[model samples]
Target: MDYIKLLFALLLFLVGCAGISPKPLSIDQRLAAIPRKDAPLEHKLIIRWNEQAVPYLEAGSDADLAFGLGLVHAHLRGGQLALLKRISQGRISEMAGPFTTKVDHALRILDLGRAAPQIEAALPDETRRWLERFVEGMNYYQANTPNTPPEFSLLGISFEPWTVRDVITLSRLVGADVTWFAYFSLLSERRKGQTDEASWRRLIATTQAGAPNFRAAENDSQLLHDLLRASGRSGSNSLALAPGRSQSGGALLANDPHLGVQLPNFWILAGVKSPSYHAVGMMIPGVPIFGIGRNPGVSWGGTNMRAAASDIINISDLDPAGFSKRSELIRRRLWPDAKREVRFSSWGPIISDAELLRGGDGETLALRWEGHDPSDEISAFLGAARAKNASEFIAAFKSYAVSSQNILFADSSGVIGQIMAARVPLRSTSGRASFIRTLDEAKQDWSTHLATPQLPMQLNPQKGFLASANNRPAQTNLFPSSLFSDDERVKRLEELVLSRPLWRVEDLVQIQTDVVSRKAPALRDDLLSFMPDEATKRHPTFVTQLKSWDGSYAASSRGALLFELLLSEVAHKVYADKKGRVSNAASQWSYLTAYLKTDLSALEPHLCKEILQDALDKAAKRADRFKNWGEMHRLPTQHLLARLPILGGRFTLADHPASGSRETVMKTYHGLERGLHQTSYGSQARHLSDLSDPDLNYFTLFGGQDGYLGSQNFADQVPLWENQQYVRLPLREDVVKAEFKRVLVLPN
Candidate 1:
């Protein structure tokens, strides 16, 4: 009776625990609790995951094991997403790939025409096992690996299962691979005829949509069908699928992404601990574990870089009058495909196919990413996540994967570093920075370029710091289409780093969080001009706040908010037209003023208006607009996941979320909220990083550690991150251990 009274009192103290409190449970024990093969999707998912993944998570790092719970939740929720990813064989065979297409064609036959006969007729005698493996692995892992059980915790930091629906919230985060518009060709192309004045806005209202099962075979099949549209006379391309790394530090990354976001955005957290090492980070469901994390001696993080483009060629349509000049038809392969059928649940052949690009061989190629080959990005990251030095980390680099990212490393040995890690295609110049792009293998070896380790750098610079704002590499001057903005940001970083020595992590954090006017120093003249001493009476109070504050743009600061508002108005009018007014990168805006000084007379009327309209508007309504940045730069998850036909033919789209706050991996806004544009959504995943590293971390869609809705973490870290503030990445505490409430031991 006395003990019961004490226990009851303690419950209130620990009231924040939303789910079942974890008790002591071993890997084998957790596996034993789930039923084996033939179990329902939910149960089969449980058994497969607890059987395989739990062993890795439990055996790996502690925080890793905790984060693994997100994988676990994904698996548990896999029934819907997985079932959705599965598609009809008819949809794929029409796709025109032999090995995969034939197998899928047979798979549909087996289902509709009956299994034994279909297999006998369609697949070779030896490959049935491969098909089985694919089916089983896809279903089980999708539903079970990222499982978040129906439990919760009060202390927001730990790993816990997600509710069935929370797993659905993972979509916005999965689409992070959109590369930067690197070169002036691409940038100017996107920037061409672009309005001088723009606002960030979205046509679709996405605040309440559900999730999609994109990785499922059905989804992949549908994706292939969609790719078939441009398949005519196109060549097929495939990657070697091997992973590589920098020659420094030990780091492993499990860079799984959480694609769409609403109230809460999430990923699994797992912890692996041993005296020699401990690592924690995220993992993806329906796939092997990890893309980024930390090991004992090394800590690392990464961002995306698209490094594929052709060699150099300066070809001109010369001598058009004569047929004697052969139209330089370089011999090569081109991938092409025939028209295909797509099975729509309600409408047959929902999406028609067209050949997109043909290879030199006139063969059609699949729409696969360069790094998506069965590579070891996970293993490479695992190796680097715990690396102790440059030498050891380079070894880990051998297995790195996914879209390219600029990795930054910091070790316990008082070393700080950065590496633009990716297989950037090779380049050649006609003795100048600007040159034509070519695909001639004889002259340029784009496929065999050196690793990211060989790129430019300030290795252990005199100043104890290194930074990257997705800028161009240090060794080059031209902003190649293969990469972007590296030199500008890199130069700026070098200036700041070399400016000071012995930077405290706090100082680095300040640098990482710096969001003041990248254009402010130049704007001083423009601002001062408006600072009529007598007219100062009409000056908004926030202007005074901005003038008094340091240049840092912390999210919650009044000055940061004011600047964001000013920019939002500008950005909305400049690009994507999501926000609809003004919101260019502060740094770019700074440069524009200089350009304006020299080119104002040559500027288009629209461009002229862009420069003056924003300051004019803010100056006129500084008090209202400058109240706070959040007013213009909101932390809203704009798109919702809804139904789309194909695969399970059931899923939602997270609509156009563009140009948001800086903390957001990619900024997003739709003209105030459903601004001008088409109604459909856009799914683009640009940045991928888990907060395992301090300097260059990608916080949550909502920012930081946990993203359980209704919990403090749901929106708790938004402002901290929006303002570029940060929460601590907790190292293991002595008391924190995996303690399951009930132990169920299983056979090894």
Candidate 2:
């Protein structure tokens, strides 16, 4: 289907006109429930008067939903968009309106650049101007949303250049399993710079116009709106905008957005009012809605699940005159911009040279790829914030403009939504577009994309239960997981949680917090493949320790001593080429086979000498010199606390921070030492967000409260986040009432 068409369908899912009911906790109660008590209210500060009163956020008897909603509403109106939403709702929160029809226009064609402007130019000038406003709305948020830090860094290790945008974009490029934004950027800076940052930035800007591009939202399911408007006669179902009550008779909505860890882990909260709606969220400074907020009965969040390539470019030593002329032929065909210009700093190919080719000279060649993905990476949240049910919730998904995410929803209607919504490209095994997994680059080709209709979903299952441990889908009917099978995190989540029944949100949270390492069992199984009989029995103590102890890498365990020995043995054999430097890009099996020789050596000084004898025999078949894996593949971690040459240099690669223990998270940031790894840390920051809903319903980041560490609410949360943990945020009015901290009124 056309990418635009899918977007049109998504756009048509926006909420329809429905009257919302009013529900609010007392003014005292709200104050007690504030997520950060130290941060003073904007209204309370004499120098900066709040435009509105905070008490009216949920003001029931006095609420006039329409009285406040307007096209232009923000701090000027006193409350932020999230606060406005707290008081506003229609009889129902439906997703349907003329605005969606315009969305369908872009969805009708795959290339928004080609379709939107051409179609709009043919329209009356006034009509075109009206349409541009909404586009401006999106850009406004993108440009103005404060760049905040993630709630915290893990292990005292913080990423320096890992932008919130990089988190969302990389998630789209790499599968959610990888977290190497800063790593990739640091290592690939030379090549990415060779590719040209200005041109790349411009290319990204074009996709932001809400146009339907293959890269914009992968396929159409990620589009926020569909280009095809559902005519009145079309009779398609609309998202249920009416407030829904769950079995407990409580209004519900679930949102799990994917974002990064930054100084500020979330958007700033602002209240918005319009004749059409009242909502509150981090209004993002200039944006009209609270991207992550709730109107009494509705609220939302996101979790990253973007899918893309995770490989790096490799350099070669072959002279231009040597071997295959096909390299020359391919370069000629691939790069037509022989005279393309390169700005001072760049990566890969020049923008003017759309045709990327291998540049010769002893210098080396450049390549491009999707980097690793992270967990936090969502660009937008407001549309879903207003959704009332699964269908409408999906409509909000139409804007799938942000990064990849698996959105979970629950509403007062007892309806629930669990959708894997993202901009995942269909790649072949060789790392290019294709329907089949073929490593042959010559055979790969882009396939037609899916539309909003193609969304991967499991709504209101008969089991009345759903969970996401940031894993691939359990519903076998869906396409291949954006991730691979070897991912330990996903594997564990599936084994422990999906194997059982999950009914409540707590069940899901339990699975998420599961830090138990089943790695010992997996390693044991790998070891079982070999018997002790294979040992030479020369080192009685070595054999005794291996056989008697369980395979555990606990910090204090001697097992780590053994494991480190194995690593050293294996690394020494695989990384040492003829020059004694590192270079083992050959077959992984060769490295593994050579490393096994070390284990044999460890067993007996000479009893197992045959393993090395056999490895030497195998090397005769290859042209390259020998090397060890450890010499070439040192664990490269983005640790901020380290001060080694490889660890402290703006971008280091020699020594790794600390990893490889099954319990410790580890990922490969592939690239050679040639300008590889510029940013030592990484591009992602993570934080689990939840509003003051008492249920851990909100998350945020950045230098909130003007960078104040002592007085700002944002400051206190930083420490908890630095530890990769969370604190409570109860949204109950009663809780707020009892511990009432402070209150201010937002004026309309």
Candidate 3:
């Protein structure tokens, strides 16, 4: 779908159109104007702001650090933090427009708002203290600030004092099992005509954990839209090469988490110093601690395990005897005065089931997801943030009960490993059926957990490195996980890592930006074999370009564009009847591979010529305008309001031509529309940590730290990020102090 449509929907989601745009707050202005009461206690610590507005927080105690971190967040990212909390608690509709009604309904069904309290209660006292202080910091910032955060002001919403539960709710959105997999699973099943109870059960029993792709589509289902809006491609590259393989004689870890491009960016960088912990890395706005950063001895990064943490069950018939139903009043933005009752069954949200169904089949589809329950997800990563070594890191994960993460750990002690961490469910005989039908089939529960001892872990493998990019857990499985990403990315990563005997932080960045498409080589070879002499002669430049191409989707390479066009055309022609079956290039490759296995005639000269000609003609029209791939394959960071055509320029980040394809190590996946690939989803955060010097961390978020349009930090990192140029992130107090631009000393 075009971004304009998305923006239109977003505009509706934000609220009824208000022509008012809030003036951006200058960083200097904000810091200089800090109220005395809101200022940090004089003896407590110093809060330094860097030139980029990244916080360098120092405090006497961990609690104080957390408090200062909260203040910094409120000062810079308070609007973002509040938005996340609101969205998680299904309150987006309260501030956003009527468009968010379905999303709000979906959230209410999952009951994240109610579950937040439970999650908060599950946190250990120590963790709770850290969290409480963080909230207090935000509340303090709010209480003292003379003006609201710019985003909040633009939306005309007043700031609310945050609770610990709000923080829990924010963390849960990241760690929860809320996925679009269930909807896709059911859609695939329905497409297969397996609507019958017995067929449904059989399908569920037959299909393994890695059954659904969860591909994006134009579906009117609110669940689909909400999930698509809230989430991006759930994959990342996290690898730690042991000291043996590094030139520095220290393990090097590289991590790039691929997610949807959002307004104001998702991850923010912060440097924290306190008596108990002093570290620097990315801090999720609402959550405490440096989420994916290095501590003193150990550095950790994570990739989505993409585990089968959810299933959709078709409850065609329910027994009235034992079932219970609950009704909740839902007030929507469109009809603020009106209240509607939404009914829910014990299984899940029945209202969503009705809304999602195509026809009134009387069959209720219940989403049984891991995230629906109250969890200690917040505690898991927080514990990880405090971990000192490999042993501690592993132990910390034992408490992780949210969605699975393929965690890669490397420490100064020369320990490098990968651990599949999450509350992996050991499905029962019936529960093993990921796609279930009927109450009988869904009755079985997931009682046994995949214990820490059983979870997939590789400690300093002989190869001297451990990596995961949403691939299969291991050669052997502790529990069946849905390996969504094909081994293309991991294979490329392994190739790059193994080929380079000695790895450096720069080498890791190169790998992160690697764009060599695995499928391209084979596809090019096949196309060359089928190219007619006459057509080849007519398009000599095109033929030559293909022959000499290295297969990297670099912006300047005309071959990459031509190849992509041809591939898309051929795939569409071959699978025109089977829509959504071979939509992606990977699926196209699979189809082409199968066809090649049988006969070569499928790609004979005539059909190949037609596909190539069509692609060439389309390319010729656009090729004259673009000098390099970047011009066409522009990566525009999204701002919530940027979707509007006129205001898009304001919300959109300065364009940087991004390299890499869907299958590349860089993995810049985007929508291919209007003969150009406009990047929408890709790496949101990239980090390279040298265990030799924990302070020698190279990291970049897709956007700057500040979400407020007024702050100078907003979109400040785009140029560096676009060029893959990483600024040094100093974790040490001395280094931060040296580079510090401003200081705020709190009063005791």
Candidate 4:
């Protein structure tokens, strides 16, 4: 049946493709089409491209460098940037038609860009000028460039001029709070009528056990979850080694940001050399700042702190006269423009008004997030980029507001430190509390804010290294966040870091790609201990293979495949409802792993035994279909457009065997579907820098640098990334000139 549906979809795609024209230009042709010599610039700037299309920009002033970066971003990622702007502004329905109307409605309710104009107005003089120049460069490229990505034509999008407000809004979109995913997971279960006290307690306990941090009592709206997922901004792993712990006798920094696996990758590799700014690292497509990279004195990387930056308020008791309301006309590509009504309370936007979250009970819920306030993340990152030392770096983000992070940095002066870079709210209830609060409770709790200085910071801890994999940081007077990622990845990193007295860059690379699962072995042993003797006899070969397994999610391991299948079956049996349907909420790996860790004897041991026996029997019957884990576990590097059946195959860059599981240090996230599954989220880009030498920096992306379809540079780095290799991005001018031969000089 699935095959037949696929065939029908393919037929439709073929019929549609017959009418499409003016195919996207190749990378070389696109480069040729760009205004190389006559680009609008205040000073001579050179953009040198390497074999993989990584650009090294050199300019006399920071303004020109910003302009050149804008041009480079627009030329390579115009489609992605355009899509991001639309997403940020709640205008995706304008291009994708009615299919995205609900998405647009949700975005409108959340108003992710509400703070952009205020942020733009308050920017420092130099920062405002910097953004103005950057916008100018982006608009110039859009107006002058002859090539347009195929997506623009296919989606019927008209590229518009860039603005500072647009830049700030996109920044807000990229930094949207990631904790909302966990929140939605918990709340969606409640919305489904699983609101019994015992069930709710079990759900919260299981979630907390796996992640081990503060959790919200109230559930989150789904709009923020969908937005963050679409934006491809998720968790990350970052570690900084002190000079004493490094073989090079200088601080070392390594980072790998986990994001949704797709094409045109989340990051673009770039190096900048100007009077005020000098650095090389990963830059987000639309934003003009080095998110993770190294300068002459310091190298820095960060993980999402998962801070409780927002709260859902129940304002049903509030007076309707106090609520502000507005309506927006949502434009659809081929369909008629639809009208959406957005409501706002004193706390924030009324999220319950959106079509996606309309509770029949007529309860009013508003989202009060720090992101709604005007904050200068642009100036923060800009300041950090040019900081000369650790103190300066720490001071740079004093005004940073949303998407709290644990920033780890290493400096050439033998300094290593971690700083909680966020403007945290000082709540009356300090510890973990329910996310959804009554209007009065919210008014009393959320009164003031804490700057970076008041937040947690470790300036050279005794451990000689700092690491964060979206895990809980050291607790201080005020806890940074109520929720965080599972501790398995951070534990694995600590174990590896402690295994060696002093580490080299090569040694750290091994840690970055480590595929061993810390949670798998314990879970596997628990299952084996509970297996019925008769069931073990029935699946002797499977039991033997499982026992011999070492808990490594190596692609070729048959044991890994068998273990995962058994685990999946066990979760299904244990979490089944009265009708025998497994509740997805309880069956999630995060909850299942934690639930299994508890004493089965304390919670119906006989039932657990029967479930285990049945699970083993079921898994054994299905174990013969595949040879190894790799056959079932795949890394899909395909764009969203790949859903279009026939031509979809062309959009798919690569579908190859992948290593690592959701809990492994090298995270490749998948669900228990009982058959072949592709990784949905994992390491998108990697950056490592040895501060001892400016030339000892390396970076790689899961996909390629170019966003154009069918470009040679698209997905060019996938093999290098799979093999754990990196491209050398040197800071020295001599090395840069020697390595990058293709140069596009923009004259004044």
Give the number of the best model, judged by lDDT.
4
Model 3: per-residue Cα lDDT over 1-748, one tens digit each: 3564566545643552332355566778768645546354424768888777877888888888888888888877777777677767767666544555655665656564545666677778988988988898888888987866655534546788898878876776776552344344345335445333433343233222222233433343534343433443266788899898999999998889877666577787887777777677887777785668888888988777766666556665765344445554554443462233444456665533334332234555666666666667556666777788889878876666556777888988999988877665575543343344456545654545564557768898998988787777676544554334556778888988888689877778888888887767777787567655766776777668767878888877777776665555555555434443433223323334434322335567576567656655554455556665666687776675564344456555566677877667887774333365566666777999998885788788777887776567777787777778886778776777788868887872
Off by over 4 Å in 4: 1-27, 195-227, 230-232, 430-435, 579-585, 588-590, 603-605, 644-647
Local accuracy of candidate 1 as per-residue lDDT tens digits, 265-372 = 333333344333455444443222344445445555543333332222222222223221111111111113323232211111111111111122221112112322
TM-scores for the candidates: 0.51, 0.46, 0.87, 0.93
Model 4: per-residue Cα lDDT at residue 16? 49
Q: Which ten residues in a row have the lowest lDDT in candidate 3?
A: 203-212
Query: Between candidates 2 and 4, which one is better according to TM-score?
Result: 4
CA-lDDT, candidates in order: 0.32, 0.29, 0.66, 0.78
Q: Clash pairs of candidate 4?
A: 214-482, 217-434, 217-435, 218-435
Number of clashing pairs, model 2? 169
Full ranking by lDDT: 4, 3, 1, 2
Residue 277, model 3: lDDT of: 79
Kindly list the per-residue Cα lDDT of model 4 for residues 467-561, writing each as its tens digit.
89887777663644545676788989999999989999867889999889867877899888888898899889999999999989989998899
Q: Show where candidate 3 strays beyond 4 Å.
A: 1-25, 33-43, 178-182, 185-215, 219-233, 320-346, 351-360, 427-447, 528-538, 578-628, 644-649, 671-674
Minimal lDDT window, size 10, model 4: 210-219
